[model samples]
Target: MRSFFKIQFLFLILIFISARLYSQEAENEKPFEAPYLFGSDTLIELSITTNIKELIRDTGKKSKYHQARLSYQLGDSVVSMLVQLKTRGHYRKNKNVCAFPPLRIKFDKASSSYTLFHDQDKLKIVGHCRNNNSRFQQMIFQEYLIYKAYQILTPEGFSVRLARITYKDSAKEVKNLEEYVFFIEDFEKMAKRNGKIPIYKDRIHQNNTMIYEVTRMAVFQFMVGNTDWGVPTLHNIKMIAKTPTSRPVPVPYDFDWASLVNAPYAVPNEKLDIESIHERLYRGYRRTPEELEFVFKEFRMKKESFYSLYQNSDLLTEKEIKRVINYFDEFYDIINNPKLVKRYFIDNSRQVRYK
Candidate 1:
């Protein structure tokens, strides 16, 4: 009896060692790659400036504050852009009222630029001034405000807008600075220009002032290039100001196409299954335990939804989709283990329930 017990104990120890080794190997393996969504062909140019204390001081009281200037040249089409000043505020107070630092921005088509104003007190540009060069100060303030406002209004899709501005202090000395602008056109526009139907449009108002809160998504059959068809791509991405003035100002970071373009596209391969899983599960309004189980089980069996999710989903690219499929085919055995299922349920049950 003692001999038989010792043999059984040895067998159990070997099984434990093998399981640990397999788990470690799985952890060290490379992750699966997703498809590459082709970017727009157009290139964008951008310039930025911040920290304009002197300009601010001089124009603080003026009715019109010049923000920034935007110039774009696309295939021989050139237009000078401007943004009308709306309001401004200091950073310490009125965090909710306006973009902190008492600044509000509005688009002015007449001037073809955007405008900036101090506080949301009125629909006009205003600035403040202290000692020296009041006239030059006002001029600079106006021009800078126009330029800043323009930067705020231009959409990222028409990627060729070039911007430039200067920031000065009370002594008219240059302070902190940043300059460069990059535009990333929305995915829908790119598809449209490439002969695909656009998936999104801005909500238009009769007054011409855009109601930024609402957007309409297109639902129709559209051809996008030769590879993929019948799906909507990402849309309405705009280039937002990273730094408002010569000094750093918090501006909402929107879709940045420039960065996306520079990054290398991932190649297709079997290592992309995790991403496939994430993309498949991310869709739909609410998912339950049974639904989650169905996805995992079906995916392990070369299911269509598992592949279709990545292929039809506008969020990923063709190359990425193939990679995810490959990963699923190769690693299904490891991925579908019973232990993984139990652990996944325990950790993600609350999230699934809430969704």
Candidate 2:
């Protein structure tokens, strides 16, 4: 009897160990929906039926989400689901500036299975600001490419999937609206993919940020001629870290104002002292010469890939492509030359420390 009881005890222990190991494996597995949604480079075709006029007129009361129907094609079938959407973002949400504001989409997780949106809860959508204007559409495409460029620079960045969407108003008589839009990956999903926790507080200083990552972010912003982001204020940037005690990494977004995109509405901040967005400014924290060199080398290694983004595109016109490449040529010239690097990067870098 004693031996039998001892065997039972060992059996229970074995079962417990197996359960724990299985749980760990499940935790480590990749999210089931991301691969289907973001794995392919091809643009996704999607349709949304909602009250378009009402959505755009929202006045930031943090009002209720407007009901909508989202549909996309898969193989031989069309998948449709009920979704909740609302106008999001400050500048884009302004009716005077943008006819169509950016959107925040919430999905029904229980019913989101077996489709591209499987296991997805919420996702941000960036669309063209103005309707009936091809120039605005082209600007959006350029912004999407900027997101792609950052993704190439770091795995710790957000992943964006471009889509061509047709907006249909159910209640109004407006014509069908077609535009190029892109879906930004969920924040929690990005942090989990990078094995980090998303930091919500904006008080963390750049000195506490990871040296190599922050330096890379700063240099990339300078290359793109963006002076719009700040780490401490969390202005147009997101933060993440391995743990609460670990140094954070800045993830930048919203580049419609970057000189690379050159949207008409984009202008330099009055306090920045720059006359125009065309002028480049280095806003990153000061780094050691060795650290700056290390970050510069990474950009140098990826130069060809960056150029190929514009050279091998089917979206932009040849004229626009040439213009963009020429703009970046100036950036490459500065990074490659020692004297120019010091003038723009070292001497022009931000001297104030954000506490």
Candidate 3:
């Protein structure tokens, strides 16, 4: 009886150790916990320290990355990480054109785990063009607002987080420079989130696109008074599809030329034959009245939410807000009037499909 009791006690001790070992192994195999950076619309503040002069001037070469230190607040702690940044854009990358060009930041994904940027790899940072120009800064914020407005319209839109950035230049006397900028969500991240894959083929016709998405994109572009995009060229737009045979869904970005931002350098496409960027044009293909009205109703339903995006913000001046609201009012008027809607959307719409 004593031997049997001793064996039972030893077996129970072994089971206890095995259970603990198994629990620890399971814990080690747990998936990474990622924090959602764009989960809210609240303003974010960030700091980036680097050689500012070299970064701004390094655009002359084909591709060069400058080491930068990025820091941001998370709860009571400030998290800092090493990042590689380089100038990104076609015209804006030119130093003569834009004093401060936009940046593409690459984060160390392995080290970024369990932080605000856990799953983040590369993110585009839209910065104010001219360093000291306040109007340009406002335009940057305006572009951010445009992204926010798009978010209100559809879940397919790219998520953006506006940030007040303080750039610390290590090489110059101007040690600190504050500016308004925003970070665009990674394209692959967004595509995966929507259970889709990004496609890179250009010259595709709009007729090959998802009708509802393409139609909404057209109306939204018209509302923003922007004609700097097209599906044929994939200019200022991205394509994503659920499957190989699925119609590509259009995702628009780069709103710096959008009338809502109205950057000083922005001009209407000469081919568009428009006097100014503010002049609205519907570049989308013609859709049935039923299809158009369905999209129109969606815009009507979300009008107030769109208005509130600018109204509730403290970034834009009273004058700026009023100007934007007035611009929106004009769009609403055009969409509401049957004659204007028919003329702009139905009658004047594109007839020839892209080859």
Candidate No. with top lDDT: 3
Residue-level lDDT for 338 in candidate 3: 90
Better of 1 and 2 by TM-score: 2
Question: lDDT tens digits, residues 1-355, model 2?
Answer: 9999999999999999999999999998956534467677788999999998887787485846899999989889988998999988887777788888888899987667777888789899988999978888888888888888888798888888999999999997778999999998888889999999999989777767887888899888888878888888999889999998788998988888988787888889999968999888888776666778888899889999999998898888887799788878988898788888788778877675549
Residue 254 in model 2: lDDT:
84
lDDT of 1 by residue, 239-311 (tens): 1222222111111122111111111221212432333212211111223445545544533444453445445
In terms of TM-score, the best-performing candidate is 3
Runs of candidate 2 with Cα error greater than 4 angstroms are 1-35, 352-355
Cα lDDT over the full model 2 = 0.85
Can you rank all candidates by lDDT, best first? 3, 2, 1
Per-model TM-score, in order, reads 0.27, 0.88, 0.89
lDDT of 3 by residue, 1-355 (tens): 9999999999999999999999999999998767697777677888999998888877864868999988989889988988889988888887677988889999987667677777788899999899878789789888888888898987787999888889998776566989888899988888888899998888889988998999999999999888999898999999999987789999999988888898888898888858899999998999988899999999999999999989999999888899899999999999889999999998989997448
Which residue pairs collide in model 2, if any?
Answer: none
Q: lDDT values of the candidates?
A: 0.31, 0.85, 0.88
lDDT of 1 at 100: 16
* RMSD score of candidate 2 (Å): 6.3
Root-mean-square deviation (CA) per prediction: 27.1, 6.3, 3.7
How far in Å is the alpha carbon of 195 misplaced in model 3? 1.6
Better of 1 and 2 by lDDT: 2
